[model samples]
Every structure is written in structure tokens, then in C-alpha cells.
Target: MSWKVTFRIYYEDTDAGGVVYYANYLRFLERARTEALRALGFEQARMLQENRIAFAVRSLSVDYLKPARLDDLVEVSSAVRELGRAQVVFQQQIVRAGEMLLDAQVRVASIDPVRGKAVAMPKEIREKFKTLMGTPA
Candidate 1:
């Protein structure tokens, strides 16, 4: 299922021209993804402490479709697109006032925090991710 997280644009999230900085959209997407995982029963601190693993952004492709000015209320919709042994791909879109402002595909790799090498996602976590992606195996 898709997760929707709403956020209001702040001065810090914008540029001098009062438009959201292009790079900040990535950060917004990241936060929404984290919240989505939390909704799926994964917390970053707990995952790191118990699984010895953390997620790292492997790649991200973003399309800027429109602009959101300061004080605009935007919602970020995120969902899993693919869940693999070592990576989870997510689709995210940022919308404001019924208009899509940004669209993105983000790939995050599961890795051992200490060794910094890739690893399989935990079975329970993988199951939830598959369910979220709606391609359960």
C-alpha cells in the first residue's frame, strides 16, 4: 500500500526566490520513505541495533514537474516498487494543490553498518515489503 506523508513548505526548505530547492525534494522523499518503513514495522535505530544493518541510498532519479513555493502544503506519496535481497526500490511523488510537483524512483540498498557490505533484507521485513509492493511471492 502507498504511504502518504504531508509536510508544509518552510522557509528553510525554499530558496531566496521562495521556491523549494530542487535538492530538498530528495530529502523530503527520504523522510517519507522512512515513515513508510516505520509504518511497516521497521525503525532505523531498532533495525541497526538488532540486525546490524542500515539502508543506504544507491540511486535516485527525480523529475521536477512543477514548483512549490514557501508555505505550500505538499504531500509525499511513497510505496515500494520492488523488493530484492539487497535492495528496495520505491516510487515517490510530491504533490501540492492536486498538482504533482516531483516524481522519483529511489533505490536503497541494505548493508551491514559495520562492514558496509550489502546483505539480504530480513525475512520479516522482506515479507512486509513484498506485501507493500503488491507483488508478494
Candidate 2:
């Protein structure tokens, strides 16, 4: 099952023409991922506070399948597509009602908060992610 979150497309999220800006979709996808983590009981800020580890976007490749306009209620569906010792890849999509507006695959790497270098994800967090991945919780 996919984790879903919805948000309104505000005017600020759009360009002068009122279509959601290309870059803002990335932001939307990020928010969905953050909320997904929160749903899994791992808050990024608190994780950094306790483990000194944070996740950073390593790379993103998005496909703009359609345009979403201001006032549209868009839902972003997210799911963990892959997991690694130091990184995770998520497959997410932005949809307006029944239509798909965008889909993206994002790679995020766990890093040491102070040094900003790659680090293995904590086992507890990994286990939590596994639950989201359809393994036994």
C-alpha cells in the first residue's frame, strides 16, 4: 500500500501563468517523503538530535507528465522503492483527484549531521522502513 498526503496547490506554488512551477513539484515530493517518514515514527529533526544523522537528497529525476494549477487539491503518494545501508530511494507521484500530474524517483542518503558525510541508517529506522516496505513491522 502507498502512503498518501494531500495539499492544496497555492498560487505561490505556481508560475506567472498559474501552472505549478516545475521546481515546486520537487518540493512537494520532499514534503510527502518527510511526512511519510513521520508516519513511520522517524522525525528527521529528532533523528538528527538523537543520532546525529540526517537524510539529504542525493539525486532526483522527475517526469512532468501533466500540469497542476492553483487551487487544485493534489495528493502525493509515496512508497519506499529501495533501501540501502546509507541511502533510500522513494517512488512518488503527484496526482490531482484522479489524474496523475507528476511522478518521480528520489534518492536520499543518510549522513552524519556534523560532517555531512554518508552514514548507515540506524537499525531501528531501517526496521521501521522495512515495515513500510511490506516486511513484518
Candidate 3:
């Protein structure tokens, strides 16, 4: 299943031509992922402080298909594509109305906050991700 969040494009998200800046698409996707995690009962800040775990992007690839203009209402969608011991790969997309504007694959790794090294996801977190992966694409 895909987790989706809607956001309105503001002036800050755009360039002088009123089109969203290419880099801002990454930020939009990030927000959706954050919300998805929250929906699963994980809050990043609390996880870091209480669980000593943090997440970081390991890799990302994006395809820009169309430009989103200022004032457009966009939906960012995210779903787990692959789950691993130390990393989770997510497929994400940004769309306006029904048109896709960007597609991305983002790999995120769990880390030991103190050691700053990659680590296995907490058992509960891993289980939650597994459930998400089982959802229909």
C-alpha cells in the first residue's frame, strides 16, 4: 500500500519561473516518508532519544517527468519496495491531480546514533516494515 500526503506548492518551493525547484522534490518525498513512519507509531526524534537509533539516506535516484507549478496541490506517495536488515528501500512519487511529476527510489539505512554506523532495524520496526511491504503496490 502506498502512504500519501498532500501539500500545496508555495512560492518558496518554486523558482523564478514558478516551477518547483528540482531539489525540492526530494524534500517533499522526505516529508511523506516521515509522516508514513509516524502513522506506524514511530517518531524520528523520539526514536533517536529513546532508542538510540537514527535513519539516514543511503542512496536516491529520481526521474523528473514533468514540472509542477506554483499553487499546485500535489500528493506525495511512498511505499516500501524492499526491506533489509540494515536498510529499507522505498519507492516514492509526486503527482499533481492525476499526473505524475517525479518518481524516485530512496534507500534509507538505520544507524546507531552513538556509533554512527549502520545497524539492523529494531525488531518491531522491521516487523512493521515487513507488513507495509506486504501491502499491494
Candidate 4:
């Protein structure tokens, strides 16, 4: 199951050719992931404040299959693919209507903001993420 969110491509998301810039796809994926967390009652800001930890992109792989033009309505779908003590792998896709435009796998790591090093994810947060992973979009 996956979490889905829709957004329109604004001019700012496009390149000079009027197609979405390759990098903007990453931004869209991030937005979707954040919203997914929010839907599960997790807020990044509060997580950082209360847990003293933050999530950072450790690595990502993306493939673009189609181009999205400005003003096009796109949907971003995200799901947790793997979970570890200190990291999570997110599978995400960008689509127009029912057509997939891009797909990516992003690995995010939990880090102690003060020490700038990896840390275990809080137990409650981990449980919530696991629940979301099995839920339908």
C-alpha cells in the first residue's frame, strides 16, 4: 500500500524548456513523504525537537520515463519499502492521471542533529511507520 498526494506543476518547477526539471522530481517526492508522515501524526519539526534527531537523505535512485509540463496535475505516491534501526527506504513515484512519469527509491537515515551521526529511530515512530507501510493508499 502507498500514500498518495496530488500537486500541480508550477512554472518554478520547470526548466527553460517548460518541462519539469529533473531535480524537481526529488522535491515532489519529499513533499509526498512528509505528507504521508503528517497523515500518520508525525511532524518533522516536532520529531527533531523532541527526539533530538532528524532524517536526512542518505541515497536515492530515480528514473524518469515521461516529462511533466507546467500546470500539469501530478500525483506522488510513496510507501515504505524497508525499515531498519536507523534508516528507511522509501519507494515513490510521480504520475499524471494513471501514467507513471517517474519513479525513485530514497533511503533516509535518522541522525542525531547535535552529533551529526546515525541514531536509532524512536520506537513509537517506528511502529507508526510500520502501520502505514501496510495501509492502502
- Per-candidate TM vs. native? 0.95, 0.94, 0.95, 0.95
RMSD of each: 2.7, 2.8, 1.4, 1.6
Per-residue C-alpha lDDT of model 4 across residues 53-88, encoded as one tens digit per residue: 899999999999999999999999888889999998
lDDT of each residue in 47-68, candidate 2, tens digit only: 9899999999999888899999
Overall local distance difference test of candidate 3: 0.90
Model 1: residue 50 alpha-carbon error in angstroms = 0.6
Error of 3 at 78 (Å): 0.4
Candidate 3's residue-wise lDDT over 1-137, tens digit each? 77889999999999999999999999998999899899999999999998889999999999999999999999988889899999999999888899989989999999997898999888999888765673323
lDDT of 1 by residue, 1-137 (tens): 78889999999999999999999999999999899889988999999999998999999999999999999999998888888899999989998878888989999999998998999989989888875673111
Worst 10 residues of 2 by lDDT: 128-137
Off by over 4 Å in 4: 134-137
Screening candidate 3 with a backbone cut-off below 3 angstroms (N, C-alpha, C), the clashing residue pairs are none
Q: Evaluate all candidate structures by whole-model CA lDDT and list the values in order.
A: 0.89, 0.87, 0.90, 0.90
Once all C-alphas are superposed, what RMSD does model 4 give against the true structure?
A: 1.6
Backbone clash count, each prediction separately: 0, 0, 0, 0
Backbone clash pairs for candidate 4 read: none
